[model samples]
Target chain A: MYRLFILAKCDLGYAEEVGEKVSELEDVSEVYSVTGEYDLLIKVNFDDLQSISDFVQDRLHRVPHLKETQTMMSFRVYGEDIGDFVN
Target chain B: MYRLFILAKCDLGYAEEVGEKVSELEDVSEVYSVTGEYDLLIKVNFDDLQSISDFVQDRLHRVPHLKETQTMMSFRVYGEDIGDFVN
Candidate 1:
């Protein structure tokens, strides 16, 4: 599976709501409100790059309250750290 | 100033510490512990792109505990929302 990271900028005060909405979508593993230029961060896993582009680039951009989004696609993930810890 | 976003993967349970150390740096505007493929998300502003590369790309990765980093440079930011709200 391909893992993608999406940084989304939403209208003020919409981070929580937007995060919630994105998390409910299939393939979206997690979403969180964060402090930064981008208000929300989303992690999605898909079968291919096209699926990520189709699902996140097309559909996610359609979500209301979002003003901008920047997506980073990983070619290869390094390090044995993180993503293994459970809350 | 050029605004850059760095998604960093650190050793398990090191997110908070790494976030703190990066935040204490001069140009780092904000750093946050996040739940996602990346363990931490850092926002930094520099006088130019070179500074971001120097500070975050060079110095940040050298920090212990961090395993990987992906930098995203924004050309133009969109939307009129977020980044304006206060705690």
Candidate 2:
């Protein structure tokens, strides 16, 4: 799987709405409203780079209230603690 | 709960080892080795800002092989998909 970390800047007071929409998109795993240069942090996983490209250009780009985005590709997942939320 | 995203840079070939140690720390939820300016992306949650400060200064600082880190505080969790893995 190919994973990407996307930092999104949204219109003022629109982060929650933008995040909700982004999170519903295919491949989006998590979306958080954050305080910094960007308003949201999004995690997405896809089968290939082509799918990622399509999602970014065709789907993510269509999400309203999003002003800008910066994407970082994840090369590997070294550790994940699912037990934190699971029994 | 307060959440933080940490961007870490590690010494050559030490990301996995550093990530393993970081993941074992209390509050660390995820660690991903990624491309671009930072080597790893870490998600952590704590009860307050003081706890986050202590974790960064006392615990995360002691993780060997980690060169530097940049932390971003999360304001809210707009959306999450645990079902992707839980099912």
Candidate 3:
């Protein structure tokens, strides 16, 4: 599987809403409303690069109030917590 | 000191230029032209939280082509290479 981080911008006051919608998508593993340059940070796991690219270009870009997006392909993830244990 | 991660978006094709200007800022430690929902990822160090916020709200937001930004204040950063040994 491929792990990708998507940094997306939402219209002011829509960060939480965008995060929730992206989280509910089939291949999105996790999403967070974070601070800094972008409003939302999304973690996605996909079968291949094409799947990720397709989702970003087709579905995500169509979301209302979403202004722009940046995608970071993770070659190696060495952070302490990859994802929060939400159980 | 505080280390901050800012995810910011630039108008298409301006990522590299914005990255350069941001890198030239007094306290900016590093800046990267990254892909995903946001166009840029910047690592900034400041003497205090006020400095960081002030830079973001006052200076960064004024950059002509900048669209938006989200900031993630690092409580603990555990990556292998904190900063590229740019030597």
Candidate 4:
């Protein structure tokens, strides 16, 4: 699986709304309203790199109030709790 | 509750080992080996900011092979699946 972490900056006071909207998108696994350079943290999983690009471009871009986003790809995962959610 | 996301860099060839070691620490929820500037992405939770500081300074610092870390605090969470694990 290909996992991507997106740090998003939303319009003022729209972080919670944007988080909820983004989390409803397909392949989105988690969404958190965060404090830092960005306003929200989004986790998305897909089967291929192309799907990741499409999701970011076609799906994520459609979310209103999102000002900017920075995406980072995850290469591996290590944790006992991981097995509980990942199949 | 206080949530923190830690971006960690590890010594050469030690990302996976460091991820496992860090994941065992108290409050750590997930650990992922990620690409780009950081080697690992870790999610941790605590009751207060002081606990977060203590975990980073005492617990996380004790883990071997960790070269550097950057921590970001999370303010809120929004998602349907959040109810599954957060109780």
Q: What share of the true interface contacts does each candidate keep?
A: 0.00, 0.78, 0.11, 0.86
Q: Give the TM-score of candidate 3.
A: 0.48
**Residue-by-residue lDDT tens digits, candidate 4, B1-87:** 778988899999998889989988878888888878889989887877777778988899889999999888887778765453641
Could you tell me how far off, in angstroms, the CA of residue A52 lies in candidate 2 after the best superposition?
A: 0.7
The DockQ of each candidate is 0.06, 0.57, 0.09, 0.67
Best by DockQ: 4
lDDT score at residue A50, model 4, on the 0-100 scale = 80
Docking class of 1: incorrect
For model 3, how does the per-residue alpha-carbon lDDT over A55-79 read when each residue is reduced to its tens digit? 8888888777888887787542221
| lDDT by residue for model 1 (B7-47), tens | 88989887667776777777766555554577766666677
Q: Give the TM-score (vs. native) of candidate 1.
A: 0.50
Ranking under DockQ, best-scoring first? 4, 2, 3, 1
**Top candidate (TM-score):** 4
Flag regions of model 3 displaced more than 4 Å: A79-87, B1-71, B74-87
Docking quality of model 4: it rates as medium
Model 1 lDDT at residue A55: 95
Q: Using lDDT as the measure, which candidate wins?
A: 4
Clashing pairs in 4: none
Identify the superior model by TM-score, candidate 1 or candidate 2.
2
TM-score of chain B of 3: 0.81
Q: Once model 3 is optimally superposed onto the true structure by TM-score, how far is the C-alpha of residue B10 displaced, in angstroms?
A: 23
Pairs that clash in candidate 1: none
